[model samples]
Target: MQASHTLAELEAVLGEQVKKLRLSRNVDQTLLAERAGISRRALQNLEAGTGSSVASLLSVVRALGREDWLSLLAPATTINPLTMVRARRERQRATSVRAKSPTAK
Candidate 1:
């Protein structure tokens, strides 16, 4: 998908994909909604790209056997080698000498 696309455009594309998947599986809105534990209207809204809750979207995708696709939204975190090297080179504690008070002089 193009980064330049608007949010609505992206939502429409996602809705189309979900609708296609459901059709391919021979599942109707009611049946899919039932399996997903969501209302049929919720499924319709999702398929129509009107709007949907994240919970509803996840439920429908899980019911459609596409939960794996959600993982792409948040991949595993990897440590940065440059950051690790810099951390190793940095001092862990301050060791500066304190100034003597005027009264001590």
Candidate 2:
């Protein structure tokens, strides 16, 4: 999450993780791709986490027997934009109130 981190680094780290997990489970990339219902190229890109689709990611996770992984990453939508805006406004108001108050610290 650091601003200085490059996209290539992120992709490389993700690719490495996927590779590690796969090798640990003794799963080959070709077999993993087949189980994920994706092409080998798509699997490669996904493990790299670069220019990959949500659907493809989900498929790969499921192939890894982690069906709930995607849901955990992006749970079923609940909060609406209006609610988010209201929350932001409340935080801003609290911050302004604090700024106006005398503090012991």
Candidate 3:
């Protein structure tokens, strides 16, 4: 997918992909919608890329046995060793420098 793709375009692509997956599995919209616990219209909306709730999308994806796709949206974070070291070396308190007094004659 191009980085410049509009939201609508992306949605349409996603809907098309879902439709393709369903077709590959030989599942019809009615059966898939029933398995997903959503209305056939909801599935149609999702597959048509018209619009659908996140819940409906997730339900459909789960019904299709593709829940792993959701993990891609929020992969586990990995901490950088350099960032960790810098954080550990940060100063905990401030110290003021003392001014030298005039020397006695």
C-alpha RMSD by candidate, in order: 6.0, 10.3, 3.5
> Which candidate has the top score in TM-score?
3
Model 3 over residues 6-101: C-alpha lDDT tens digits? 988988998999999999999999999999999999999998999989999999999999999899989988999998988786688899997777
TM-score each candidate.
0.80, 0.56, 0.81
Off by over 4 Å in 3: 89-93, 96-105
Error of 1 at 67 (Å): 1.2
Please, what are the lDDT tens digits per residue for candidate 2 over residues 1-102? 465879877766766766778888999999999988999999888777676776777787777886765577578988798988877733433333445446
Each model's lDDT comes to 0.93, 0.77, 0.94
Ranked candidates, highest lDDT first: 3, 1, 2
Candidate 3 weakest lDDT stretch, 10 residues: 96-105
